[model samples]
Target: MAVTLQSLETKGLPPVNDWHPDFCGDIDMRICSDGHWEYMGSPIGRESMVRLFSTVLRHDDDGHFYLVTPVEKVRIRVDDAPFIAVSVEQISHQHVFTTNVGDKVILNPQHPLRLSDEGAGVPYILVRDRLEARIHRNVYYELVNRAELRMLDGQEQLCITSGDHYYSLGMILEQD
Candidate 1:
């Protein structure tokens, strides 16, 4: 899962990778406050805040904005007078046991919920009512939208640019 571009380089790929995608969920949308809305390689912070009487907005971390760690905090924006959450003690994990497939309690049938064995069959998330945050002054697309898994026969690495930034994404592998 931690594979890098080097993994593909050694495999000997070619030039000008042609791409065709078949899904909408493949995009990771980022709506930057600086009038830039782009799609990137990772998840865009699902929360966006608009500046009052202005176009600029700011990014509030899911509290896990750091480059190396992963955490999920759902607050949309930092308070005008920022305050860090302090708990009396270790935060208690709220147990959610609506999974009928996993023996437990709290079953609500109005919302779609299902889980199945993963290793032995297809694994996927259930489609349900969801909210997508789109807070940007404008619209843009990022390299995540340019992904192409070209067949290994004869293809190339990817070098696409957005604004003044240039990103070179190397070849992707194909398995038959």
Candidate 2:
């Protein structure tokens, strides 16, 4: 399917959530763990193109990522999550995150944050419709600075609150 910049300009992001397309086989595209988008073994350098492609990205129940358009769906490899949380801000007691693709997600029950056991428990937040953005190291540090010690299940944990929900950053490891 052809997705033109002019079409995107007129309609904003495509209704990918509503459009279900058939898989068109895998493409030589990958979202690297370090938050770089690559196509055909080279980096996709244009931010506009990346942002445009990101709008049509989707995660299917088959445990794969795909770029979906109304007429076609093509799989892509993702080393980690599809997007990276580049920065975060606390606005009106809400933890707001900005992804590399320019998507802003408010951390709440609908867009909750979770810690991955991989590599010192990296944090990730849901951007939209089950698509998550791995929290950048510096942004994770900012969250740690804002976290407070809280008791959960009889264990001391560092947690950040967004609205009425408390999400754990991680458990405190006691000194040996």
Q: Pick the candidate with the highest lDDT.
A: 2
Off by over 4 Å in 1: 1-57, 60-156, 162-165
- Against the true structure, candidate 1 has what lDDT? 0.23
Q: After superposing candidate 2, which stretches have Cα over 4 Å from the reference?
A: 1-12
User: 22-100, model 2: which lDDT tens digit per residue?
Assistant: 8789999999999899999999999999999999999989889999999999999999999999999876677888899
Model 2's TM-score against the true structure: 0.90
lDDT (C-alpha) at residue 62 in model 1: 30
TM-score of each: 0.18, 0.90
Each candidate's root-mean-square deviation in Å? Answer: 23.1, 6.3
lDDT of 2 at 105: 79
